[model samples]
Target chain A: MTGVAGVVLQVLLVAVGSPLLVGVMRQVRARLEGRAGAGLWQPWRDLRKLMRKQAITPAGTGWVFRAAPMVLAGTALVVAAVVPLVTTESPLDGVADLFAVTALLALGSVALALAGLDTGTAFGGMGASREVTVLALVEPTILVSVFALSIPAGSTNLGELVAAAEANWLSLLSPVTLLAAVALAIVSIAESGRIPVDNPATHLELTMIHEAMILEYAGPDLALIEWASAMRLTLLLGLLAGLFAPWGIATAGAGALGLLVAAIVVVVKVTVLGVALAAGEVFMAKLRLFRIPELLAGSFLMALLAVAASYFLV
Target chain B: MPDLTYTELLYLACGAFLLTGVMVLWRRDLRAVIRLFALQGLALAAVIGVLAAHQGDLELALVGIGVGALRAGLLPYLMARALAAGGEDRETRPLVNVSASLVVAAALAMLAYAISRPLTELAPSPATRAVPVALTVLLVGFFVLVTRRRALSQVVGFLLMDNAITATAFLTTSGVPLVVELGVSLDVLLAILVLYVLTNRIRASFGGTDLDELRELHD
Candidate 1:
């Protein structure tokens, strides 16, 4: 029961912490651009403001449009619950595997895309179509890269994988983990609607994919989707950290004090990653839709090489 | 909830194979077929999940849930939107008829059983009851890929085949190493994405995504 209670606490921390990671990243981006940004609580403030504003649905939109934002945010919460951030063991951990996490992310994207098209706007349809096209390449790379790591860990349970990484010799030299980490990093940039895939800052209608879909969203509805998107970005990066750098995750048998320290470490690591992403985005340009596939394919090849290297080296 | 028995899981796998096979034959509506495919994915996930839980292998349980989420939830959602956006919402009439597909499906199942006999013999797990069912699904998926005229159908078939392979891995080994399972599913999803892109192009130039029309590479 204590173990179960610990898992619950870990999930709550991730849920609240996910938004903070976003806040910190935004602060970092602002700093890099030579402008003082909003305080770290800006996201929460934005969400409150959006909630107070009225939602103006596009006339052609139906139930899917109304429900899409909720589902997107809902799925993100579920994914957050399942993924290990501060601890190896989570309550909802066994409800899915790592592949499931990818699927959940993909599922959120699909819902968002469907909502984008349900409005019957050309931009909406175009954005949805392009989103799937880019994702097609990115999704596999994420999976294969993770596979490279799982082989060395010898388990699919995210918790077990973390534990294995802590316990194994192969964990050190597994080129697959490195390849997967790199591949996941690329996919995260793409998946999160960051630079070199789609620009989060741009409203250039022709180039926009993620922004185009949400162009019609305003107020609280838009706020949830945006927050969820940020959380998704943080979550994927946190997953990369958890799986690849499990040094600080509270082991299943660790006490409450150990988990507290682990949670702090997770915050520090995710904050660093968030800052790095902001820096990377500041320096990069969004790739054309056609060119994005090449980027993801490169990640896939790297992951494949990692897996191959693992087989020979480990 | 008493632990789910191996026999129940076997039934679920067999049912999944049947539903997916029938979906290939009965549906021409792309969106409808995608929904059916999602259901088939759920069935596949259920079988794996139950088996994993029964064995108390947390890793397998995770894989089962993950497979369910991806195959059942995400892929189908993507296909549905893609079909809708392309305005390719019609039922795809294949080169072959429904009756022929059923016959082929049965034959494929038999072939799978025959081919899997040696492998099944060597499998140490008691969950081998679904071994033949898994193989048959794979074979049927291949048949759908080859015999179907529509690109979407072929892709769905290809995915079903991948699910069959995943199922086989589960039944034979009780589950794969988590990372390997992750890699395989990722590969399968990636393959589906590639197929989706190709289908989009095929639809754009050819006005439809019929496999018969994709003969530009053919002499």
Candidate 2:
């Protein structure tokens, strides 16, 4: 019963706290670029404002477009519940395997892509095509890198991997862990449609990948998609954080102190990650679409090397 | 002296070496290619350092220092000068395209692994487990040599192949004769100097370092 409580709390916190992460990133990026940006609470205000506006559905769009935002947000929320956020003692621990979680993410994005294609706009089709290309190249790297960590745990379950890592944090120093961490880091940046892969802040049709798909969306629907994007970015960052450094994440059981310790630790970790992401965005140019595959290929090689290193280096 | 950490580091170096080979094919800029070649040389020197520390061979340490200083440091410096002197920017054209060469390079790597399995099994030391990587590096180096059209890039490929073979020999045997190691090191150093001279000569005479220019001699 306590475990179920923890699970529900984990889902609520992740969904609610995720937008603050985006605001932090925006502010950090602005500050890094020598301008005072929006307040840390700005994303919350924007979401609230968006929710009150009228929902506009364009002609030629039917059920798919109408339901896409809800589906996207729901899928992301399900994944958030699946991660061992505050406590590994969640009732859903068994449901939180790596492949399944990654598959759910893919399904959600494919839903968005299908919605984009259904709209019959050239920009939407272009964005969907590019998203699929990025997805195909990135998914293998994600799987292989996660598998590198799971080699020792003997299970693809995310909670078990973190538990195994917490038991022996020294394993983090292994070349396999280090390499896979690097690969995951690159894949995260690419997956989230950030700089160097796609620029999220840009309005130009040529550079927009994620935004183009949502161009026709308005009001509450647009808000949900935007909120869902923030949540997705935060969840992936949390996954990377938990995988590489499971410290301060509750594994055995949590008393009040344990939960607090874990909460503080997670906040610090995600803050550092958001800042790193923003800092990286500061200097990187959006890579030409052709050049993006080379970057992803490099990550794939890193993941492959990680697997070989784990097998032979042991 | 710990086998586990040593094994991990060896595998790490091998991975890095293989990555450098892949990077050489992936990069089009001549300067980046030479830098990667130099990085490979640095990784090779690191392997030498590890092997020497494990075997406690003072002469091997000296060889590592020589190789590190020469191949990783001076050789890259010279190549950069050669590139600057020739005023060429990239390997703009190749017999095999970059993407095709990358695929072929991967196939060549697997072939190197398959071919070297018997030799890897013959070695007694745990370090010999990395021999497949050395052979792969060797073959990938040869791949780079045959496919690239630039004089400096070919020089890098030749040096890369030679370095891989030498690392494999030393890794399997544990230690080479000090005099032999020193002799090979000196020979490479001298050969690079000569190569530099030839690079400059080619540039001066032809205004470029593209080896395709020499094909006009069908006497």
Candidate 3:
């Protein structure tokens, strides 16, 4: 019963709260840049406005374009339900394997990229290609770094990994943990279309990787993509916090009160991470497209080192 | 602040040391390279300090402080001074590009782990376990020396190798004698002073400190 409630709570929290996470990040960046920005509810307001408008499909586009947003949002929702965000007793624990979660995320990305290519616009195809390039480099780092983390826990199941971390907090200070944290942090930045990888705020034709793909998206479709993206950012940040700092997360035997407290704690953790990421973005410029591969490679190296350290240093 | 054991803390320091070494290869700016070298030095000192605390050896603690001061403080300051005088702040083009250098660094790290297995097997303790990281730093430093074109970068590479040697000595044997460690630090200081002068001379003669320009004198 608690497992069921945890999934529903996680899904609701991610669905309702991720937009505010995006809003908080924007506000933080705005304040840092000395702009009196929109309030924390702006993303929610934008979503509301986007939903009321008529959805548009471009001429000659097929089901891929029509279906991509739903696919993206659906995958994110499933990930939210399964990722052990508020509690380790996720009902979908069997599907919460690290590889399964990563592939689920990748499936969303591939859906969007195909949609981008289906649009047949030059920018759409270009953005699709670029996104795939980044995804290719990022997936390995994510897998390997988490693989390093899993070495200590002896399980690839997300729930078990967090449970192990909660049991032995000392492992968080190990070199392998630290290295994987740094590597995963870098890849998360890249995977989420953040600055120094892809500039989320930019819509300039040449510099945009993510924005170009969504250029043809409008109305409800655009809102789904935006909401899904915010959810993904929240999910990744929440997962990092859960994996590295599992404090306040509920264990298997927890009751209803424990689940509620865990939900609040996860919101706090993800919010803090989001704000920090936003503040960090204020100081960084987007890397050149060619240079981004180098950054990703550097992260991959760290992930590789993390795995090596986990084995040899054990 | 966490209740980390001595071995875990040492591993963290060694990881920081190895990371800084690889970052030196990734960064193009000479100043950033020097900063990373200083960070590596600090990490090396940390490795010593952890060992000192683990063993409760006052002498090792003192050596750690001296190493931190000399390597992290004075050496980087001197290198930065040379950098300001030389005016070429970037390694515009190395023999290898940044991505390739990073991949090579990963390969070297793997190689270090493979080769250090026998050492670790000979005596399976935490300290011996971390030897491969120091060895990785050593190989990466040598790779930097061989591949980088700028004389200042080469100096950073040499210091990286020196730092790795110091780290290995401390990790494998707890530490060397205080007097020998001090003498080694002084020798490094002297070497830096000589290199400092030589770098300035190269800048004066060639209007830049790029070593490739010196090939004209080979004839």
Candidate 4:
């Protein structure tokens, strides 16, 4: 019963809070750049407007284009429920394995990438190709870095991994933790289309990676993609906080009050991470497209080192 | 500060040591390479400090500080001076590209792990277990030396290999005699001074310090 309640709470929190997170990040970036920024409710307002507008489909697009937003939003919601953000006692514990969660996230990305290709626009194809290229390099690091954590935990389940971290807090000081943290941080930035990889603020087609794919999206479809993207970013940051700094998260047998407190703590953690990321973005310019691989490759090396250190240093 | 045991801290330092070596290969800027080499030196000092603290050896601790000063401070300072004189900042051409160099580095690290298995199996202490990291740094430094075209980068490579040797000595046996370590440190300093002068002479004569240009003299 508690597990079920926790899952419901997580889904609701992500659904409502993710847009606010996006708004807060944008507001932070704006403030740092010395501008009068939109309030934190701006994303919610934009979503409201987009939701009321009529949907439009570009010519020659088929089912892939129409269904992509649903797939992406659906996957993000599922990942939100499964990952141990607010509580470790998720109802979907069996599906909360590291590989399952990663694949679910990749499924959303693939759905969006295919939709981009289906639009038959040059920018869409270019964006799809680039996203897939980054994704191919990114997935391994994500898998291997978390695999480093899972090694000592003795399970690949996300809940179990977090539980292990909580159990032996000293493990956080291990070289494995440090290496994996750096690796996962890099991949998270890449996955979320943040600056130094892709500029989320950029609408210029030449430099666009995430934005290029969705230029043709309109009305509620665009809103869904935008909301799903925010949720995805929220989830990645939340996962990083939960896995590495699993201090406040509610564990198995935690009561409803514990679950509520955990929710607040995770919200705070993810918000802090989001603000830091945005502030970091203010100081960074996007890497040239060619140099981006070098960055990802470096992260991959860190992840590999994390895995090796976890094994050999033990 | 979580309560990391001595062995865990030692492992962390060694990890940083090896990571700096790989980063040296990843970066194309000569100044960044020098910076990473300095960082590697600091990591070496960390390895020695951790071991010294674990063993309660004052001599080793003092040696760690001296090595840190020489390798991290004095050596990189001298190298940066050469870099400033040369006026070229990037290692634009190398025998191997960045991606390939990184791949080779990974392979060398794995090889180090494989070959160090017996050595670790023999003693099987935490310090002995971490010898492979030093070995990896040694091989990577050598890789940098052989593959890099610039004299300054080669000097970094030489210093990295030297740092790794120092790390190995500290990790396995705790410390060598203080006099022996100091003698080696002074020798390395003098060697770098010589190389620094050579780099400047080469740059003046050839208008650049690309070692490949030295081959033109054969014709």
Best by TM-score: 4
* Residue ranges of candidate 3 with Cα displaced over 4 Å: B1-4, B176-186, B217-219
What does the interface RMSD come to for each candidate?
17.8, 3.1, 0.8, 1.1
Greater-TM-score candidate between 2 and 4: 4
Q: List the residue pairs that clash in candidate 1.
A: A50-A220, A100-B66, A150-B179, A155-B178, A156-B178, B28-B91, B28-B92, B29-B91
> Please, what are the lDDT tens digits per residue for candidate 3 over residues A1-314?
89999999999999999999999999999999999999999999999899999999999899999999999999999999999899899878899999999998999999999999999999999999999999998999999999999998999999999999999998898889999999999999999999999999885887789888999999999999999999999999999999999999898889999999999999999999999999999999888898998898899999989998998888
Encode model 2's per-residue lDDT on A1-314: one tens digit a residue: 54665667667777888899999999999999999998899999999999999999888988999888988899899998888776777778778989988888888788888788878899888888988888887898899899988897788999889888999877787767887998899999998999999998897997788888888888999999989999889889999999988988876657767776787787789889999999989998988887787778777766766676565445
> lDDT tens string, model 4, B26-141?
99999999999989889998998988888888888888898888888988898888898889998988898786777677788788899889878988888898988888899999
Question: What docking class should model 4 receive?
Answer: medium
* Model 1 chain B weakest 10-residue run by lDDT: B1-10
Error of 3 at B176 (Å): 4.6
Stretches off by above 4 angstroms in model 4 are: B1-4, B177-180, B217-219
Judging by DockQ against the true structure, name the best candidate: 3
Give the per-residue lDDT digits (tens) of candidate 2, residues B1-219: 887677666766766776786678778898999889888888888888888887888887787878778878888899898888788878888888764665566566567667866876676466777776777678878988998989998998888888788778767885567688768878888988898999888888877889998777797
Candidate 2: misplaced stretches above 4 Å?
A: B93-112, B211-214, B217-219
lDDT of 2: 0.82
Q: DockQ (Cα-based) per candidate?
A: 0.02, 0.35, 0.74, 0.64
- Give model 1's DockQ, 2 decimals: 0.02
Candidate that would win on lDDT: 3
lDDT comparison, 2 vs 3, better candidate: 3
TM-score for all predictions? 0.58, 0.92, 0.96, 0.97
